[model samples]
Target: MTVYRPPARKRLTQDERRAVYERCNGHCAYCGFELETMHQLHVDHVIPMEFYELYEVEGYDLDSMDNFLPACCSCNIYKHTYRLEKFRAAIERMPDVLQRDAATFRHAVRFGMVEIKQHPVVFYFEATGVDVPSLHWDAEIEKKYRTGEQK
Candidate 1:
């Protein structure tokens, strides 16, 4: 998979943003939120930028948007680190692959929706500037615009 680093925003424009949205079908790939509903529009790396920073720090490609994935804020938050074990155990059991899929994690583990209270963790991502998933693991199958399957 090609590695991707977000280029300076100044280097991009509306067309690029639209391209991203179109690539993702203008919906949050993780939570399946409609794009029109959320005013926020931004390209998300399916993998977090931080991870690539680590890889680049160790010497690797730092600019590959191929790994990018579009997502809404809520989905992004849930996917990033929205792990609440007790709560998760309480909800409808998550499928094995879904459990590993970050996109499904938040919807499954964030709020007591699945069961535990994650106010502190949720608030942390909120309080900090971080938002939805912009990247995904390079090895991950990326959404190919036509199929729901990640490839």
Candidate 2:
């Protein structure tokens, strides 16, 4: 797996950051903790930024609204440059991590941050050799979101 490094660029303006927080209901997308009570909140890329550089020849807009999510400091640090599948696997192996991240893990699945496939129903992160049960999503729903036809 590649480590995603965000490009050096202007940071999101206060208004833009505020919009993301509001969109996520002022809670950490992964943990659902109220942002107001937390010492800090981080704006995260749902898809690792490194993925864009590695796969997209046209370049990806890392600052796009659809790619951003609100996360608490711990969640942000814990997630680091992991792809969603890897992050989910890590959460599952550790009881405390799972307890703190279950809601967010389910949210990622439902929202299509993590890909789902049937077959043997296993998810594997090649870099880390972590495997876990597959999460499911409605393909049509995910397509709608990906195409900007639905929020």
Q: Rate the local accuracy (lDDT) of all candidates.
A: 0.48, 0.60
lDDT of candidate 2 over 1-151, digit per residue (tens): 9866757644888888887676556777776667894337698776666655532333345446656777888778988888666876776666445436788866777798854442321322222232211111224445656898832
Kindly give the number of clashing pairs for every candidate: 20, 0
Query: What is the alpha-carbon lDDT of model 1 when measured against the actual structure?
Result: 0.48
Cα error of candidate 1 at position 107, Å: 20
TM-score per candidate: 0.42, 0.55
lDDT of 1 by residue, 21-103 (tens): 76556665544567893356555555445455654543443344454456677656545533323223433244444556666
User: Which residue pairs clash within candidate 2?
Assistant: none
